[model samples]
Target chain A: MHSALRFIALDWGSTRLRAYCCELTPQQELVLLAQASGPGVVKIVGTFSDVLQQVIAPFVKQYGELPIFMAGQISSSIGWFETPYLNCPVTPQAILHSVCERISGQQSLYIMSGLRYQNPSGDNDTMRGEELQLLGLLRRYPQYLHGQHLVCLPGTHCKWVLLDNGYVSWFKSAITGELFDVLLQHSILLPKPATLYTDDWATFTAGCQRALTFPNESIVHALFSVRTKQLFDAYTASNARSYLSGLLIGADVGSILHDTKVESLPTGSIILIGSGALQQAYATALTQANQQSVLITEQEVVLAGFAAVANQTLLPLSCQA
Target chain B: MHSALRFIALDWGSTRLRAYCCELTPQQELVLLAQASGPGVVKIVGTFSDVLQQVIAPFVKQYGELPIFMAGQISSSIGWFETPYLNCPVTPQAILHSVCERISGQQSLYIMSGLRYQNPSGDNDTMRGEELQLLGLLRRYPQYLHGQHLVCLPGTHCKWVLLDNGYVSWFKSAITGELFDVLLQHSILLPKPATLYTDDWATFTAGCQRALTFPNESIVHALFSVRTKQLFDAYTASNARSYLSGLLIGADVGSILHDTKVESLPTGSIILIGSGALQQAYATALTQANQQSVLITEQEVVLAGFAAVANQTLLPLSCQA
Candidate 1:
């Protein structure tokens, strides 16, 4: 067998699960061997063990008895195995150390721990798989390790993390994506047979501007505009959908800009971790909020994160073996 | 037939349909003859006409062929018939004039038009049944007819209306109730088998304070605290629900307090129109925002509105007859 360290990395969230077969090179480089996906933790029909077994079967056949590192909702109570949440100001090493391990069949599985943050007012906030992404970001861009930085992970529960000198200090989570989905599907904002959202940048920008203009007002009041604009024939259903997206993303980004703590930070470009349409949408919103943003794909960060974990744990073990 | 002018008043909304057999006396008194309710326009299984017939069967048996004055979602496109929305700075008489008339079977049905308001920024807002509530409030409290007053009708789409000398000068709709329901039922904030929301005023008040404290922030950020508090064992599932309610209601009221236009108005006790728990909740939130609120039942205001319509349209025709 080759001396290179090998392991499987899993990004299992609420709706989707992705498994990456990875190898750590001699020169401390991480390369993806193969990747596969299945239903997420929530979408799994059978037992989690059964779903995990099936998802990792192909990877196991090629690389027998490899250690598997799982992230995302797969570490929550409803996930495969519940893991502890490490309190912030947490480090990537602290997160790796807190990982819960169990042997499933013949494979060693490690579930990553999430981070919990308490604001000054004593309100608690949390994130799971995204911590790995933040860690990956830190690994990729070491410059952030010595300075204060802001990283936003936009997803079902969009997260805004404060990275201070390499520690995940404090973070806030916004239910932007979930709220948009719920409002479009369930609230009166959308017409019957939900309108398919198109990439109408003009309409989206207008929504962002509206949200930014009323930075102090609750979005609940502004959301009705979605329905009203459609009712008045001022917006197409598709445009309305896009506008709703813009409103939510705008509000999310706007709040961060309006945040006194965030405002106090050195006006640095926010590190946005995500890809495709959502990332673009957030970037547009951040620009509207007059904040600069740097984009990093989810795949890149998650891979870098798993590689960090692999280098810390598997490399040493493989060398010893 | 009796000389008194008689009509059937309908408060048909999305979830429930209410019909009042009403008589306008010679002395201009509105008397409730009888009342019945059925599934709302959206809940009707077969047809709208069929549902209306079933809901008003008893009222019809007692009052004979009376003109039906319908308000609420019954005037929307999805209702029995779509009525035009009167432009804002609208009065009760203006709304009555725009009523769309149709004969369903043997009943003379008059579906009241909703009111549409366009703010200075050209954003449009429309309200259907709540306009009747506002008109009713105007009739019940004529003092509001000559001065600036803010009237809040809290419901699924809570309406914050500005009345300038009895004209509904402008208004805003916040999806507070709808958002609360949707988030509790569909969002990750709640656990599976959804937490039953109970009235825990202390926890609720805490939530209200939090929202009011950060009046400028989007609630999407605050909402995740509901899950975190529960996860941390700091809040029970029930208390979390109450806190969620407080946050939404606080945000709604906070926006009004923070609104420059609303702030410029002479200080007066805001008139609150609704009944039961929602009204009480809003009153509490208003109090938390340090604003005084005067309460009126929804039934009283809606009935008054229908009476105003009957006095304007039905009484004159009956006198001629």
Candidate 2:
């Protein structure tokens, strides 16, 4: 049961595989000295042994198999193996066992379960990457999110999860991103520029403000105004910013904040994940809506989550027990 | 002047232009005789005279003047003549008029003014084409739209206009289309290969219904489920219908139906102007939304609108007295 054993963490996804080598020094502190990423879980198939060998190549030389664990889509049915999800309201034991078969003579491999949420609406739903991010968010802002907190992780399918007293009570996901894409390009709005250029917080915040203020006209008028402005005023492709920000945030607020008392949500903050324009857009939305804010990095949380599972699955028998 | 004179109406904008010619049947009712279109006013500027001659070749032979009138962006500053916009709450007298002589005294032209909507939100917005379409929508459903009515014209910029009696009282527009475009394509769920296939009004209505019931999550999570169903369960591209249906309608309900009595608006139900997919998307939304609906053709409204203006402007004294 060496607490000092180097703990290896992996953040594997559709595109790339990244790993970090971490260990506790004598003062009992975790240090990450090396990290690397390669062509990810999507490229590999039933050849889990070969895929993993390539994935862990960077860290294998430094730490052997002192202790390791993984996260991301790498554990999905299509990735290394079908790691059945743990129905959440999960504890340590609620975690799913990995379906990985080991090398001829090697340390055991354990994969954490992804989370599935039954929409009370009778829709089947689950999330693998974000719940780990939520877990990481809670660890970072434990005191701030003491009661019921709603975190918005914006992306392809933007997720809004409810964290009641640090245990996920209910959560929902929306495909704001996907809907936006099909509508803009394929719909009548094309023949205009392919993209808007105002990639700043002001654009996003103004959009969020519009969303909170007028849920209905917010998106529609916002778009029409872009054409109107371009035709009538000094509008660049940038005017699309306020409209874009308004649609995503406004739609989120519309979908998530129904019958919700603005004053009552736990510490009243929305956490936004992802990076570049998206993070800023969420930040803009939160500030405009006067809701509190927290940002958990998309990459870091996945990394920490892998480490969290590693600490739980591959550490000492006593530590894991 | 012969009130029996054959007439032609044109609506031109940045991307496209269209014209409709109507002859007074022996019965004295306007009947469509011929129609044509090309790259709108912006592109056909230099050849305006030649195109005008070719367009009205039939009418010119029948009547010497061949008086023609245009509307929408044709009257905008970018229009061939730069006819300016009139203030809101205006009358026919207030219309900014521009006259042009094309093809060396070959044809006489008049362009119409666009409407300006100045509301409390400081939205001094304007519309070129749809107002005429709404006028035609009213022409058809005079019983429903004659009184106070809320008109929902969906497109890149969806419009929510309040009409007092027959005149437009005030209106607002949003970029629901652009948001839907960017979000769907560029965001995470872009994997679904189906292009803008028709919407599954059932799923879309469910989404719309979900929006009215739980407005908060309508925008974000509403989209992803479609993709998941497609990816995991082999949901057809048609299944993306619910996504589009939900998105277009869900966003409409979520963004527009705020603290106001979203359940009910003015009695006219929703009057949709855009055609094909956009129109169907709105009809599905209005159905789920429990709103009566009417759709006006893109071609007819713009043409009828030009006729409406021609009725007022070309021979103002004959009708005014």
Report lDDT per candidate. Answer: 0.86, 0.59
Interface RMSD of each: 1.0, 4.9
lDDT of 2 at A55: 64
lDDT of 1 by residue, B64-179 (tens): 77788899988797777888888988886686576677887766788888889988888899999998887778778888889899989998889998999878898888989889
What docking grade does candidate 2 earn? acceptable
**Model 1: residues >4 Å from true position, as ranges?**
A61-65, A103-107, B42-44, B61-65, B319-321
For every model shown, what is its TM-score relative to the native structure? 0.95, 0.71
Model 1: colliding residue pairs: A216-B216, B72-B129
Residue B230's lDDT within candidate 2 is: 58
Q: What is the lDDT of residue B311 in candidate 2?
A: 56
Which lDDT tens digits does candidate 2 get at residues A190-286? 2345774545555455556666766544344455554554454454556554565465666576546653533356455576777876776767666
Kept native contacts, as fractions per model, are: 0.89, 0.54
